[model samples]
Target: MGILLLMARERVPRVMRGEIPMASIAVERDAYPLKARLLSNNFDNQFQLPVLFYVGALLAILFQPGWPEVVLAWLFVATRYVHAYIHVTHNRVGKRFMAYAAGLAVLALFWLWLILRLLILAPSI
Candidate 1:
């Protein structure tokens, strides 16, 4: 969303300059296919993989896991920053994949820990 907003800010001048048609801003892809399009795609990405984070976080909070789980959650969020950096900047495929995989692994660990806490540890708690 921040990236989208920044892109929109940058685009205002282009729109005023008549470089990109106002009507074609959202719909017509072929008409405007470059920085603007990349920004839109990047914005769309926020909704894709991060949904897992939201679910994992909700479960973690509901279960009230220990500090280790909280650390793991923070690790996942850190990876997201790295992922976004790689995505918006250099955007190297291999680098981006590594960051994304790291985040996914952290998220998976978070879910695993939460599940264990719920099923195994919760009985004792």
Candidate 2:
């Protein structure tokens, strides 16, 4: 996504006008203008809660989750798509936050379910 963002930025004539050097962005958070900055921030956001999703997915694979877990996983991915759409587009905080919170809730439930499954399936000492 970061590479894609950089490629997209190159296509924008204004970004290529040399107003803000690309190098500056690495050193300064505010180097990119509003839209570019928002995109950068959104790209950075992919790493946050999604890291947990990756772990949960791995665990799910190892544990052989049922249909319910599969549904929750899809729901979580869907919410993230909605959140990123709102973030990079209109960027209405209220709506974006709702999507974010929904994803977080689903993620928490996913982890909880995984933990419970592990405990229930554990062998007796």
Candidate 3:
């Protein structure tokens, strides 16, 4: 959630203030600005994908989804957070790509499931 990210950012400033004398935070101040920009860009993209997903979902509450679909959708949301975490924390490119791919797979599968359900059920109307 964006709120969670904001809360996390607030803690960093507080922690940095506490540790300035020791320079415990390893990251450079200038580098953080660029890192932050990349973070925001990813967050923006993540938010947009879910908005479009739910819009399709809203169009067809005629039949609510089963548990797996809902769970997978939630997994996509969690995976996005994981994607951002691996990217900024460990800086592991391979891990970041894996997280991102997992999220995309969930989204794409959810979309296809919703579309097929709607089309198959359309004959009843």
Instruction: Show where candidate 3 strays beyond 4 Å.
Output: 1-35, 60-62, 122-125
Candidate 1 overall lDDT versus native: 0.79
Sequence-dependent TM-score of model 1: 0.84
lDDT of 1 by residue, 2-78 (tens): 78786687677788889878788676655554666666666777787689889878877877668978899899889
Candidate 3 Cα lDDT to native: 0.66
Clashes of 3: 0
Better structure of 1 and 2 per lDDT: 2
Better of 1 and 3 by TM-score: 1
lDDT of 2 by residue, 1-125 (tens): 64356636643565478776667765675765667767777778889999999998998888788776799899999999899888877999999999999999999998888777778754531
**17-78 per-residue lDDT for model 3 (tens digits):** 67333353355433345455455456666666678667755654547776656786788779
Candidate 1 deviant stretches above 4 angstroms:
28-30
* Decreasing lDDT order of the candidates: 2, 1, 3
TM-score of each model, in listed order = 0.84, 0.82, 0.61
Poorest stretch of ten by lDDT in candidate 3 = 22-31
Screening candidate 3 with a backbone cut-off below 3 angstroms (N, C-alpha, C), the clashing residue pairs are: none
lDDT of each: 0.79, 0.81, 0.66
